[model samples]
Target: MITISVTGMTCGCCVNKVRDKVGALPGVTGVDVDLADGKVTIAGITPERTALADAVAAAGFHLAD
Candidate 1:
């Protein structure tokens, strides 16, 4: 599992959106969003950070270091 910080998510819908967006990426096995912590945890087989970042960006969020 890998954890990434994400910004611009303000509600449950935002969390779900982030979750869905990241969950659908290739090799992604699971996704968990922590709104209060502003973080997302992804579980998968060798998922790339750049792809995850792109997916989050496409969803209108920023993935931070």
Candidate 2:
């Protein structure tokens, strides 16, 4: 799993948005979000960091560097 920190997630809807965005990417088999910790865990072959960031951004969230 690849773990990344994100911001602007505060509730179930936020989690769902992140999950759907990240999960839609190629090679992403799974997506798990930790609202309290602001973490997103992705399973399967890792995609490019930029692509991941873009997906997160499209969902209205920012990925912490």
Candidate 3:
């Protein structure tokens, strides 16, 4: 699993959007978004970090370092 911090998520809708977007990416088998902690945990084959970031950005969120 890979855990990435994300910013700009404010509610359940945000969580679902993030989940749907990231979960749709290739090689992503699972996605868990923790709204309170601003974190997204991804499971399955790890894609490139850039791809993950792009997916998150496409969902209207940013990956935090």
Candidate 4:
């Protein structure tokens, strides 16, 4: 699993958005979003960091350090 700390997600829409976008990534089989914790856990064959970052960016969010 690849874990990314996320920001700017406030509600279910944000959660679903992140899930849909990141879930579309190649080899991504599962996604777990923790809204309170601001964390997104991605599973299945772990994708490239850049790819994930770009997807998050496109979704109107960002992966935090």
Better of 2 and 4 by lDDT: 2
TM-score of decoy 4: 0.95
lDDT of 1 by residue, 2-56 (tens): 8889999999999999999899998889998999999999888746778888899
TM-score on alpha carbons, each prediction: 0.91, 0.96, 0.95, 0.95
Clashes of 4: 0
- Going through the candidates in the order shown, the clash numbers are 0, 0, 0, 0
Which candidate should be chosen as best, given lDDT against the real structure?
2
Local distance difference test, candidate 1: 0.89
lDDT per residue as tens, model 4, 1-65: 87899899999999999999999999999999999999999999888889999889888999997
| lDDT on C-alpha atoms for all candidate structures | 0.89, 0.95, 0.93, 0.92
The candidate maximizing TM-score is 2
Model 1: how large is the Cα RMSD against the reference?
1.0
Q: If ranked by TM-score, best first, what sequence of candidates would result?
A: 2, 3, 4, 1
User: Which whole-number lDDT from 0 to 100 does residue 36 have in model 1?
Assistant: 96
Clashing pairs in 2: none
lDDT of 4: 0.92
Q: Over all chains combined, what TM-score does candidate 3 have?
A: 0.95
